[model samples]
Each structure stands twice: as C-alpha cells, then as structure tokens.
Target: MSTILVTGGTGNLGALVVTRLRDQGHEVRVLSRHSPEFPVDLRDGSGLDAAMAGAEVVVHCASSPRGGDEQAAGHLIRAARRSGTVAHVVYISIVGVDVVPLGYYETKLRVERLLEGSGLGFTILRTTQFHDLVAEVVDRVAKLPVALLPKGVRVQPIAVEEVADRLAELAVAAPAGRVADMGGPEIRTLEEWGRSYLAARGRGRRVVPVPLAGKAYGGFRRGGNLTPSRAVGRTTFAEFLERRG
Candidate 1:
C-alpha cells in the first residue's frame, strides 16, 4: 500500500479526503501544527520531513478562505523537496479562479502557478462554488432582515461531497497536469437561489439585487466564476438545503 500525506487534514474538505484515503486502505499521514493535537497545519515546514518521510503522494488542500500570504504554498513545496520520495502533489482550486480577481481567488491562482513551476508531478482540480456556501450566506444574512446581492450574477454551485470525491480520485490518480474543470449539474442566478433559500428557512428576508461593482463583482456578473460545460456534480441546492435541516 502507498503512503499519502495530507495537508489541512482537520478541515472540512481535508478531513473527508483523509477519511476516504484511509477507508480505501492507503497508509495516511497528516501534516499539522500539532501533529499530536488537532492534526493539521504542518505546512510550517517544522515537522514536514517526518510527516512526508514515506508518502508517495501529497495532497495540498490547505487554503485561507479570505486569502493572504502566498508563503504557505512555497513552504509545502520546500517540504516536498526535502522529503525526496514524494511522487505527486494534488492541488484543489476553485473554478474560474483565474478569471476572478478577488483577493482570495487570486491567491488560489498563484498557488496553481506555483504547482506548475515547482517541476513536481502535479494535478490541479478546479471546482465551482460549493453548496455549503449557501448555508454560510444564510447565516450571515440572518443577522439582517435585508440581504444585498449582486444582480445578474450566475453561479454553478456544487455539493461539497462531490468536490471531496473528486479530490480523493485525484489523490490516487497519476498527475494530470491540469484536469478538466468540474461544476454542479445546474446553473442558477444568485438572487434566485437566495430567495429560494430564505423562503425554505421561513425567513422573509428581502434580497436586494444591487449592481455589483469592482473586479470581483464584475467577474462574478460575467459568469467568470462558474463552469457551464463541466457540470459533473449530482447534488442540487434545494436538496442540499433540505438535508442541512
């Protein structure tokens, strides 16, 4: 059995990937700040050598949601080089990250470039916004009776489970350089889904569709953050929301 090293194993996506790998019988190792506690955050490079010692694959899943500090990606590369036995590095990125100029999306794009230039065997899977995001938005909007959203913004939101499954498959496959993008089965306007979501929760919140301004808003309005052709995920927003309750 091959040994695999996972970064951010304690996170939502990373935890699923680690669990799936272990279930498949691969010897799994997780890199973390406290290798003995919480078990996630080893990209600091302190315990990387020990974490990656015998692993043949390294799945890079650690990411700052709001985005900052590109140094973390560099550290992972350094650790992999030091390990000297790593065969593949799989990176999980968001769909249309290159098109969106948002700070966090920019960071993800930069990490993709780092993977390409590192000269290591690598695979990059770009997926769409996850359905979990809907829950987050609801929670944020619940504080106010009115929620402001960008008008005409389209999104192909996939299930988090779908993204996890794809990550697991990439972790075990040969480095594909860059794989075809993946997204949810359908595309919907942000307003449409937001209304459906609030109503489902029995919340009579007013969703104001404001014309979004700035690079991030422009990109989203232009459908730069969505995947129209690579719809591979099976779960729907309605299904996900119902399941959440």
Candidate 2:
C-alpha cells in the first residue's frame, strides 16, 4: 500500500476520496485546517512539509473560488518536490475553466497550468458542476417569490461521489496529464434546473430567466462549460433530488 496525502480531505469531495483510498488499503493522510493529525492550511503552506513526508501520491482537492487557489497549488507543488517521494499529483478542476471568463474559473485555469509546468508527474481531471452546488444555487435563487436565473446558461451537474471515485482512481494510477472531461448524463438550462428544484421542494416560486450581460455569462450560454460527449455520469438531477428527499 502506498502512502498518499489528500488536501482538503474534510471537504465534500475530498472526504469521499480519502474514504475510497483508505478502503483500497492505501495509507491516506488528510491535510486540512481542521484535521487533528495534519492541520495544514494550503494558502500559506504551513505544516505541509510534515504532511508531505513519505507520501507517494498527492490528491489535490483543496480549492477556493474566492481566490488564493494558485498560491495554494504553488505551495503544494513546492512541498511535494521537497519531499522527493511524491510521484503523482492529481488535481480536480472545472470543465469550462479554459473557456470561461469568470474570475474563479480563471484561477482554476492558472492552477492547471501551474501543475503542467511543475515538472512533477501530474494528472488533471476536469468535471462539470457538482449536484450539491447546483442545488444550492437553485435553492438560493428560489428563496424569493421569483427565482432569477441566467437566460441561456446551461449546466451539467454531476454527482460528487462519481467525481470522488474518478479522483481516487487517478490518485493511484500512472500520471496522464489532462485526462478527458467528465460530465453529467444530461445537459439542461439553469432555468429548467431551477424549476425542477422548486417542484421537488414543493415551492411555488416562479423561475424567471434574466439576460445577464457579461463575458462569463456569454461563455456559459454558449455551453463552454458542458461536455456532452463525456456524459458518463449516471445520476440525473431528478434522481439526486429524489435521493436527497
């Protein structure tokens, strides 16, 4: 069994990855701010060296949409290189990071490039929006009497469990830089998702499509964030809701 280190191991996706890796008989080290054993913060790289010690593989699942991801990734790469034992670094990124103009997407793209040039054996898996995130967005918008959604934006929400499974598989395999994108089984508009969410919750909120003007929104409307060909995810949005209920 190999010694693996997982960043953000307490998060929704990272926790699952850690569980899967441990289930496979690998020695998994969880590095997080709240972790009792390795309380490391990725933004500043504190306590990372100890966590990196003797780790053969690193699954980088820690990310912040509010910024600081690039810094965190840089620290991780440096720490892994310093350890000299980490052979593979697996990263989870968004599907439209390259095409989308959003700030957070731009940050993710920068992190991907950093991994590509870091000289460490690395694998990057880009996936669509998670079902929980999509559901959260719909729930937030549906709070008021009228739910305002992007006019033409589309989303392919995939289950975090499937993503965690894929990441866990990549964590142990040979490094193949920039793997194929993973997407949900269906591609639907944000409006439709919102409507479905409302119906599922038995909420009588009306979904209204708003034509938000922005390059990022334009990118979303053009389906830059979708991968219809890689719709290998099995759980549909409706199924996700049903399971939640």
Global lDDT scores for all candidate models? 0.83, 0.94
Per residue, candidate 1 scores C-alpha lDDT tens digits across 1-245 of 77898887778789999999999999888777767822444335566666777779998887777554367788778778878889899999888789888888888989999989997899999998888786677568657878877799888889888777888888899999999999998898888888888888898888988785798888888889888888988988889988989
What is the TM-score of each predicted model, taking all chains together?
A: 0.94, 0.98
With candidate 2 superimposed using the best TM-score fit, by how many Å does residue 168's alpha carbon deviate from the native? 0.6
Model 1 stretches with alpha carbons more than 4 Å out = 37-43
Return the TM-score for candidate 2, rounded to 2 decimals: 0.98
lDDT of 2 at 45: 92
- Over 144-179, each residue of candidate 2 has an lDDT whose tens digit, in order, gives 889999898899999999999999999989999999
lDDT of model number 1: 0.83
Provide the lowest-lDDT 10-residue window in model 1: 37-46
Q: Backbone clashes in each candidate structure, one number apiece?
A: 3, 0
